[model samples]
Target: MTLVDFATSSLSVLPAIIALGLAIITRRVLISLGLGIIFGALLLTDFSLLESGKYIFNTVKGVVIEDGGINTWNMSIVAFLVLLGMMTALLTLSGGTRAFANWALEHIKDKRGASYLAAFLGVFIFIDDYFNSLAVGSISRPVTDRFGVSRSKLAYILDSTAAPMCILMPVSSWGAYIMTIIGGILLSHGIADYSALGAYVRLIPMNFYALFTLLMVFAVIWFKLDIGLMKEHEINAEARLNESHKEDEDHVDLHDEFGVEESEHGKVSDLIFPITTLILATLFFMLYTGNQALSSSELPFSVLGAFENTDVGASLCYGALVGLMFSLITVFKQKLAPKLIGKALWIGARSMFGAIIILFFAWSIGSVIGDMKTGAYLSSLVQGNIGLHWLPVILFILSGLMAFSTGTSWGTFGIMLPIAGDMAAASDISLMLPVLSAVLAGSVFGDHCSPISDTTILSSTGARCKHIDHVATQLPYALSMAAVSSVGFIVLGFTASVLMSLAASFAVFSMVIAIMKMLSKR
Candidate 1:
């Protein structure tokens, strides 16, 4: 085939490749994604500039209007995300988050305690990675800064816990969406109505990356184990604090420059009640939407069954709306003027504009990729290279790379899940769960480290840390976990026992951490 003919192939994944390259090179996700969308439109139009422009316009219009498949659910996610941004702004403006920080700082004595508290908050908010990143980073930044914990370290804790915890939890939005992908694949394979939830539950122990990533957060904190770039950042943070102390003895303030303004009247309950309401409302809306999604024949209802039927984006949107309403009521009760609350809400929504733009472009490229059958091409390419025994490890690595390049775990999941599911069903691999778990684990691992990832961005934004600094510091920690998890997946490929594999993986992680501790001492 000629060069032009080759480029026009139906399975071309060049648009995504170009997009990722642009993102990495320019460090501008929106521009990269927009370029990718343009490239995809051009490809669809056979390089006709006029047609490509029209195609691009239609794509954006459809995405915003929810006029087609996948975009509708995606638009709902965007709505909730904007609502969540508003909610976060209100919490910050109302001083609920600041009060919570004070409450945490009172008990958290020293840098180590502050780090653990930050990690704990990240773990606690498990509903959505976006929420987890925003809430934990904002809440923990003050306490972490109080004791000179690096913004990078604070970002690490926030990024590490967000997606990893979401993936491990079967009830979260991540789990629900993944289950749907698995269900579709299974149905295509003639396994009529297999329970994706049941499969996901069984695979939890197999998610070594998520498990190890969470544990490593504590291991690093407790052992004071700082390795690679993170170590340097922590040391520099201490040095800066000391320098400031000596230079301005009378002017020295313990508060971080990024610290939120405190409210003397703000109670811990101010933070707790609204957050609790958000979580509860999300679950309530999920279940309610799930119930409505089911057919009369499909349910007199079990929890998993309802989850399998759930409209993830719609539920999240509804939950966010409920949370926003409760937050307004709470702010009013706090004696904040209605106008102030309204202003805060608008400010919050405005803050999400950047994230919203990225999401739109991300979804656009995802649609392009889907239409091009890029995932299928990737699956085909990999299937020819690997034996069934090697499938789990290989898929893990491939999924990781895809997620790292794409900078959006959900988009990666949408691309890879069907491919992995179909491959598992077709191959003698017989162990689909391990492969699925690996995909989930790897996607999170990639997101944890990716400079362009939304969670990573939010973590830095939340901590008011330099974005590249957060990426640089978190990469070493993420790579450490990924190295250990890679070995764990290989072991699981051979043994195929989730419990035994988990135990073995945990042991491997401990050994790795022990070695790192010894090396750091040296």
Candidate 2:
């Protein structure tokens, strides 16, 4: 509210916005995010040339080292990503992907089915958005291409379902982060009419952005809607398929021989073991984090302490190591040289380099935003002006804008959750309903469109497609969902009835989509 605070907040946002603009124009997400971090650090240091270098170093160090370092949860993400890459490499080496693609081609054999499968996988991996994006992209890309689905469309499906689905799942990392922020807000306000945890659980079913995104994913699959970059991909795929078909038998066989030479297939056990280890490890991690087994432990350290100390990154790293070892054992048992295992590991690590760089930049940017107090400053400006009844919708929009501008959903939730919770408490609104919903909606909306968003970048990277092409093609879908969510919140503000809010939202969304389709045809 103070001029200084307003100026600082405004200044903090500039770097992120510039980064986004640069990303949009250049189609380089990591570089854009890195620039945003540098800008934020410089701004936070008051543009003092002498202090700017220190500020940037501190920012990076704080994220990568201090307080258990970026190796904590981020490392866990990297571990999973590395594991995914290894799995993908192994599948690729073993020709499992080709086999699966051939199997899919024999069955569904169409673009519609491929799209639906991709969407369904997105929904199925609801436990974590990071996992969903990587897994869906890696697994479905081949089949989708075989069926003529565009890489942009594939990216859209992967990005659409990632954060939105994770936000709705109570047991995921996204839920834990939101809950911590909400708990802080509730404790500060001394208003306890609604249970912060329970409310978020209830609101998940009614979150218009989350639900609408899922719907749009399905709609895209069902309708095979091709617009913008998606249309370009479609044209390319069709042309490639046609060209492949028209090639002379000898020429085609020669090309196929070269391609087939690179393909390898693993035994069934090779596939099952690593995935099983990953699932069990993830479940154990979740249970530990959730404190499900706290009462059973009587060690010097409390169960919570033990859980906290159990680094997700460390766990994942261990798991990946185990997976690599298992893969080697399998290969050796089959009398294959151990050198092949090294190649698999090298290929997996190589594939994950881009993801690792993006993750690092995302974390650095988040740290810069935290140091600048951007969220707190923004929250102060809107605290009293937005009424209790209208806070949800308003905060939803604010969170969305912040997230979109910063291109970081975690940063958006971290900043907005406390502020929204405080505002809701002060206005006599239920802390859970407005605060949690706003955080969820805002995070999803931001991730949906922010050119610097990691998932956005990964979605493009996974599809091997152009980044801006994906952003341009997916913008309309994200906005349509946002518009529907905005109307849903407005209705909820008046009625506060979950069923009615959701029904009205779905109805309105369907009507809008129908109208748009009709207009397009005309």
Candidate 2 lDDT over residue span 1-522, tens digit each: 111232434665677677778877777777877888777766666667668787777666765566764546665666667776766665555554666677778887578898888888888776556656766776677688777666778888888887788787765656656666666666777647656566567778767898888887887677655655566666676666667533321112111422322244444445456555555665566556445334345444443334333334554555556555554555555554446656765676666776677667777786666666666656666756555667678878888877777667877777777666656655665544655686678678978887767778777766656677788889988888888888888777777777777888888888867865654444
Question: Best-fitting candidate, measured by TM-score?
Answer: 2
RMSD (Cα, Å) of model 1: 4.8
Taking all chains together, each candidate's TM-score versus the true structure is: 0.82, 0.85
Residue 522 C-alpha lDDT in model 2: 40
Go through the candidates in order and give the C-alpha RMSD of each one to the true structure: 4.8, 4.9
lDDT of 1 by residue, 454-500 (tens): 67777766665666667777877788888888888888888777667
Q: In model 2, where do residues sit more than 4 Å from their true spots?
A: 1-9, 67-70, 183-197, 245-273, 288-312, 322-334, 430-432, 515-522
What stretches of model 1 exceed 4 Å from their correct place?
1-13, 68-72, 181-198, 227-262, 295-298, 337-339, 407-429, 449-469, 497-508, 514-522
Top-lDDT candidate index = 1
Worst 10 residues of 1 by lDDT: 249-258
**Candidate 1 collision pairs:** none
